[model samples]
Target chain A: MAVPATRHDHPPSRRAAESARRAAGRSLRLGFLLACAIFFGLPVTWLLLAATKTQTSIFSDHPLSVGSFGNIAQGWSNLLTFNDGELVGWIWNSLYYAGSSVVIAVFLSVPAGYALAKYDFAGRKALLVLTLIGMIIPTAALVLPLYLQMNALGLLGTPASVILPLAFYPFAVYLCYVYCTTSLPDSLLEAARVDGASEATLFFRIVLPLSKPVIGMIFFFSFVHAWTNFFLPFVMLSDDRTFNLQVGLMMLLQSTDAINAEGGFSALPIHQPEAALAALVAVAPVLVAFVFAQRYLTASDVSGAEKG
Target chain B: MTDTETAGRRPARADRQGRRPASGAESTVEPPSKRRRRLAPYFFVAPYALFLVGFGIAPALYGLYTSLFTDSLGAGTEFAPLGNWGEVLTDYRLVDSARNVATYVALWLPSMLMLIFAIALVLHARPGRFAAAMRFVYYIPGAITGSAAALLWLFMVSPQVSPFSPLLDLLGVENATEAVSANTPLILALMGIAIHAGGWILIVYAALAALPRDVLEAAVIDGASSWQVAMRVKLPMVSRYAALILIATFAAGTQVFVEPTVLATGVPGQISSTWSINQLAYYYATQQGDFGKAAALSLALLLVGLVVALLVIYRTKFYRIDRGLS
Candidate 1:
């Protein structure tokens, strides 16, 4: 009777011990995660708060406190009217460059990917290898050559300088290729062909409709890359009028001392709060886009790119 | 009605012909009409090929040619063979830039890896609705160009007007100048970059998620804890992804231009003009007009990029998988 009772007791004791261990592990993980979150989150959180603070209060007050709501509007006004509206122009240039590049990149990459996956042809292997090599080479290393090429073509200081180079996003092509090869099967293409569809008809009518998610992913990736790019535009464009947001921000940082010396309210443009507000403005579009498309941008895409 | 009937007739013919080997029927149905179809692949690839040859291959070759000679920026071209390479190899600024790059890689790579891996593990172990949201938030900075992100960090770290003034005060920093002084700016800049580039970590996290669940389940069943399974089982399996990340991060980190450029304004004499190879090249090209040396420096960076790329290709078996051609 004692042995039976002890055996029953043994199970509960083991169960209790396992639960305790799990709870401890869970708490430890959560603590580590929370700490990391705060560490990374603090700077961004500070930026959000600073955007609402007036320039004087930004320096004197508690750093994390939200300022009067009025400061947010004031900051927006300062950012807009700064240097006769150069900030707004810079933002528009960024959108133009990134948006056009994304559109062109998708058009080229999707068709190329579809062709590579569905068509059996000679030199396919070499083309795929070229795509991989293109993806691996750093964009920084290519900037000089690209600059010289643009200069030779008399396209320097033009938006074409940024837009044209960005259009050749090999990574997107590779991603589309992998997505098509895996998610799409050869049998479907064969079926479409058997139904008397021409190659163009098959691609447009069949493949592209099924490829919306991957297309969105590629657009987002390319758009973000082009938008955030600095080195290329800095090298290519000489005029501030043609500058994108990244280049414009650099110009602002460089000229902050001059602005401070001017002393008038209009001349003393782009103080600390305004700078933070501009940075927020710069990243806002990308943040909004990411939020909307967060579901499709999964790890599977990353792994699939590698494995495929 | 005619279009549907024509389409319906084609499939029936295809079905009948597919069952039997009909060389005659195959020609009539699918028409090997022109050799253009045979050459279409190369035609599709020509523009990119031209780009590779013109921009990539030619300039790389030209850079090598220029690096071997010495020429002044303003003066007409004159060749002093292998002189610039020798001088650059021994120049203090070049040496310092190399050291800075090395220090940056050492500090940046490990921190980036650790933060990314830790966050990924946490994300994987307990995925919630907020996990995706957090990933998107972190990645947003990456989409902001390097200059903009650097500019954002400048505001956040400036002691005088930083919203994180209290945090900086805790660290004993008094002003923006002191916060971005020479001794500490590189470290601060690196930390900012690591945080800003955190979105790439999602790539590694995705790789982790795609690991066969059975392998992890086996480890768990065999009395392994989550940490142990992550460390011993998962980490080793995903070593390829880690290596890929390291190589890429190392390459990108070496090309540090904008961070140093923006930060240099705050600390002028401390960070020299030619602080990085890219900056040095820019100086030679635009400021000094020494296109030869600039070309040489660009070539040197290109070589480094190639070696790094080749290392990735060799180790990761990047293009080893056989798709079709045996």
Candidate 2:
């Protein structure tokens, strides 16, 4: 079957043209891919390199070069001792906020999603619409109302103000809804019901077990959103002690004069290097999480694509 | 028939038997009243309904109410009755912000479409180990915190220490700090966000993947080039996905707060507290303590979001579901 095609093949010019087309296609793909990699990858590389340099060296030396170990050690020390050990406090605050919010968001959203997906009920359509609206309505638009609501309850400057608002994950609910409805067949649930399994038991034992892919996706998404959330925390929490990693970095960037006043050994102010280092610290967890759970997320994308 | 098939058939027979009067052991269960059965679905949806009322519906209604009146930065509330809307329409700052946002949308929407389509095309054309690796790397930044991304861009765009400073110099751009002024900063901010968001457009790419391969093969046989195929056949097929992306991008674009607020450092006096609608609302409520106006601005944004949401849902056929079991 394969050999017959060679005898029937076209003349040299046509074959050459086809080969040229294939080659051009491959080169285009590679060129564009390389360009995109550089476009997205350059900033990250800059951050890594800048984190190693001192403030003076950042400007004076080649921006892309790896600096000496002495400079990196000094940068680390500056990050640690910046604002008299506040960086550590901010890291703790971020972990507490993002970690708790992720747990609560997943907890609330999963069951709610299961309920919506498995049970046919009144207002199910309405709830789905509301959730869609909630997902689309950028959180920034609602920040004012949320802040006012928090202020009325005198919850401003408190962690509850941030965590409570972030916990309301409409998008997670949507994700879980999609996952459960499509992936978890009803016959399995019907069989479990016949075996005298209660709704709660079924959910925990069967539904939750089968939902690992989506749960991981939801957790990663919620964690990243909560972790990187700055506007809400910035507006709600005035106390620097309560600032999350993102807000902490913002404050560090803003405090350029104060860092200069610290009278470091170098001529340059430590703000830029410190800012880069702080940003790296903030994004580190998300990068780690992405590496681990990315296959699941991409799988979800593939499934969604097939569905679409 | 096998025992399992007989067992499955037995349930249908039993169901029919139970329906007949006094014919089976299963008939003893109480038949629920129609009203009670109807109400059960509502009970399942009650939590979300209540949440919508309190968190979603009420605040939005209150915002519409508040926009009608003028509350003088917390001094006192006075009934302005169309006054605030007039001010929103007439105020210079608000007008400038609107114009700025329009310019931003124009610049951002096109760049995002071009870049996302280009990247997605590349990924689709070559589906292998490298494609997977490329997708993961591009998406990693998006998974990071938005604020961190913004902060990262601050260093990247700053002339004093940016690795891209040499590239900027090569482009004959002077003073990286000045390059991020109000007029130019929005584009830079959009580029930062675009870099962060390339991973998301993979959804559209996924949609593109679902387009029949035979269609492309046919196009190729018919002498259509790759570019021609992408533009003519592929794009038209994925119009719905593209529409979804456009609506989503527009809705999210209006809420541009973090990027501008962070980049505000480079451009002083040009970037205001109320650069975007959300920021306007924030300034009114937090800085000025004017809840009423803030509410008004939020309501406006909510309306825009609602329209966009409805458009996406309607266009995407998101509501339609077919259960093969039924």
Q: Is the docking of candidate 1 incorrect, acceptable, medium or high quality?
A: acceptable
In order, the B-chain TM-scores come to: 0.73, 0.70
Model 2 residue B28 lDDT? 54
lDDT of 1 by residue, B1-326 (tens): 33224323322234334533321243444454224345555555566555545555555555666667677558656677767776666667888888877777677767777888878877777666767756765665455444445545666667766656677888898766667663453544455454545655665555555554544655655556678988987777666556556655666677666667655644444466777777777777778766666776766675686578667767765434323211
Question: In model 1, how large is the Cα lDDT of residue B198?
Answer: 65
Tell me each candidate's RMSD, in Å, in order. Answer: 9.0, 7.8
- Is model 2 an incorrect, acceptable, medium or high docking prediction? acceptable
**Model 2 Cα displacement at B15 (Å)?**
25
DockQ of each: 0.25, 0.31
Interface RMSD of each candidate, angstroms, one decimal: 6.7, 6.8
* Tens digit of per-residue lDDT, candidate 2, span B128-211: 678767876677556544444555665666666677777666656566456676246454445645454654554545555545
Question: A114-142, model 2: which lDDT tens digit per residue?
Answer: 77777666567788877766766645346
Note the residue pairs that clash in candidate 2: A122-B41
